[model samples]
Target: MIVAGFGWRTGANLGAIRSALASAQQGQPPVTALAAPHDKLALVSPLAEALGVAMIAVSPSALQSSPTPTQSPASLKARATGSVAEAAALAAAGPGAWLLTTRHISPDRTATCALARSCTEGPAQ
Candidate 1:
């Protein structure tokens, strides 16, 4: 199965999921996701409709983040915690689990580390 994930930012994840789905050699259904509330996922309705896939939000806290239009400490913490949790969850999933996040992850970032771990541990040779 071709599994993919998306972050709150709409465009990037939508395109990534669509590309992954399209590139699959095996016939697999594409699934899109919202970072938080189910209602928020509706924002991507057009993409969902276009891809013929449904959007699902994981956890409410997952949507919270740091770095607002103006940056602050609390915002930073929120972003860090939420990102860490999100990455951890994705890492725990099975192989071929394509986790596409809209957040820009650095090389040593938590999300990046988690994705690397998940991809290595989950996917079967």
Candidate 2:
């Protein structure tokens, strides 16, 4: 299904997301996922294996902690974040690929449910 499963640490792009969905519908190839960055391995490895999807790990060591500001910033810097940069690179390489979110929607809807949603293209909620 070309499901690119990832986490909040895993960046997703609209182009890639669309591509993954199209590829899944076409059934021309297995879902292509980008493994979470190396630092995120402890988190994404098991989930990726459980889903049984094809993934290529790139710059796994690039994952680092980022802080989200709750208050308005004095300046609007266009600096891109971690996974977002990865997703952009992927988008450049291949458009319309879906990058799965690493963040869980809920406790019950973890690995399996997320995978199901990718396969079924239905809401996991």
Best by TM-score: 1
Worst 10 residues of 1 by lDDT: 108-117
Worst lDDT run of 10 residues, candidate 2, spans: 67-76
Estimated TM-score for each candidate: 0.36, 0.34
lDDT of 2: 0.33
TM match of model 2 to true structure: 0.34
Which predicted model would earn the best lDDT? 1
Model 1 per-residue lDDT tens digits across residues 24-125:
213332333222234445544566567664444545343343211223344246444444323322433333344433233322221211111234444433
- Runs in model 1 deviating more than 4 A are 9-39, 61-125
Number of backbone collisions per candidate, in order? 3, 15
lDDT of 2 by residue, 84-109 (tens): 32332233223333333322222222
